[model samples]
Target: MALFGKALLIWLMILLLAIANGILRESVLLIVVVKTAAFIVSGLLLCLCIFIMTYLALPWFGRLPASHYWRIGALWLVLTLAFEFVLGAVIQGHSWAQLSEPYTFKDGNLWTLVLCVTFTSPYLAARLRFKQGSKFL
Candidate 1:
């Protein structure tokens, strides 16, 4: 329960960051070489934020059974993806195909990075050693 609460907070933070980035994306797009590059850059930026959050934030949740990390990571991924889809469909008025476009990497979309980060963050956080060479959340 504690693990889920902490992971949910982290996921929410990441989601807010992504939404803020999307809002600013239009201005950033002006200087980008292409749309695909912009997408890639945004995805990378979000991943970096995830890494930082995992390092600094996870500790607050306290220690957990090692196996919980895997469940938390999976939960984060599932919830985040579901949020994205619903936001795209209901709020943004994007069609199913349009929302699905991000996962279509062959078209040069970079959203795959988002998935990779989500899937790995909790487990990575669990494995990371923090101050005093001790394991953290």
Candidate 2:
């Protein structure tokens, strides 16, 4: 469907942003902070970026019921999870335990929190946009 196509496009953009965030964390943040702090900061930054991207892209979906936005969020969440596991474990050859380390919440890895934001951002963005009387909506 056109709606899913648009959501997929937006998710690809988010993926690029996520990759950039990881680069920044490794090259810059790690140099400036402890590893735990870097992970937390990077995760927070990614969440913020995801919400901003979702809000900006809201108009691209055209006018839709709130449920559609929720569905978009769900789609994004599923895509993100698939990408992480498939790319990290299958392509990158990481062990399952290694790939899932971030989900354990040890060492200040906020991946679970990031996932929560990714799963909810679309609906939250729609709510904010609607409250702001965005003409695009």
Candidate 3:
């Protein structure tokens, strides 16, 4: 239960990072590049941020087994999808098609790649941390 709580907290932090990334995408990237390019760049940036954050937060998981790390990643993925679809459609008034557009890979949107990264980051981070024998871990 404690581990699950910690994972949820970490996920919330990741959500904040994502929100910041969205702001950057809107304010900076969109101005600097075409919409397609901005979407691609934003997705890649988010993936890098997620991986780095997961790496840094691994110590908080306290030397968990790899399976636990995988579970954490799965949890994050599910939470992200639910938030994107539910909140985007209900609160934001985006149509279902609009919400699903990114997944179509049209206009260079890299949402699918971003989701893959989100699902794998925790396990990948844990592997790297274990391989490096991080003192914090």
Candidate 4:
């Protein structure tokens, strides 16, 4: 039960943090800050969200050979690109297909690889953290 609570809390916090990107937008609160600050915050949030989700899902990946972790990461990246960029706007009734037509890459827009790295790094970190017998600080 404690593990469940820990996982749930982490999930909620990660979600709320990620959602802040859209909710906060680029308000005067952030606009006044240095340019790099925004990107740093953005990167931190992505890393946190990826960490929490992948950590929670790790046990579900049981008995899968260690060699396949990258597959999980790749699938996650594909899903993210599909949901967030491709189908998301359509679901929201926006014309995403038309907008993406201007771009040459059918695989995904520019941030796909960036988001993939964000997702994978945390899984690796959690693995390292476990191996090192460290707890979250």
Q: Pick the candidate with the highest lDDT.
A: 2
The TM-score measured for candidate 4 stands at 0.52
Tens digits of lDDT, candidate 2, 1-137:
59989999999999999999999999999999999999999999999999999999988898889899889899999999999999998899999889989999887899999999999999998889988998877
Ranking by lDDT: 2, 3, 1, 4
Error of 2 at 51 (Å): 0.2
The best candidate by TM-score is 2
Q: lDDT tens string, model 3, 1-137?
A: 49999889988998999999999999999999999999989999999999998888888878877788889999999999999988999899999889989899897788899889889998888878878988754
Stronger candidate by TM-score (2 vs 3): 2
Per-residue lDDT of 73 in model 2: 90
* Higher-ranked by TM-score: 1 or 2: 2
Report lDDT per candidate.
Answer: 0.74, 0.93, 0.89, 0.53
For 13-126, candidate 1 gives per-residue lDDT tens digits of 877877877765557753765777777766777787777776677677677676776787788789988898888888999998898878888445567877888788766766
lDDT of 2 at 16: 97
Give the residue spans of candidate 4 off by over 4 A.
1-17, 25-36, 87-114, 122-126, 133-137
Cα lDDT tens digits, model 4, 1-137, are 44445444544555566567635536642676664565455555566566766665555444334445555555555555665565456666668666554244343222433475645753584575568664441
Where model 3 places Cα greater than 4 Å from the true spot, the runs are 135-137
At residue 23, what lDDT does model 4 achieve?
53
Lowest lDDT sum, 10 consecutive residues, model 4, at 102-111
Return the candidate ranking by TM-score, descending: 2, 3, 1, 4
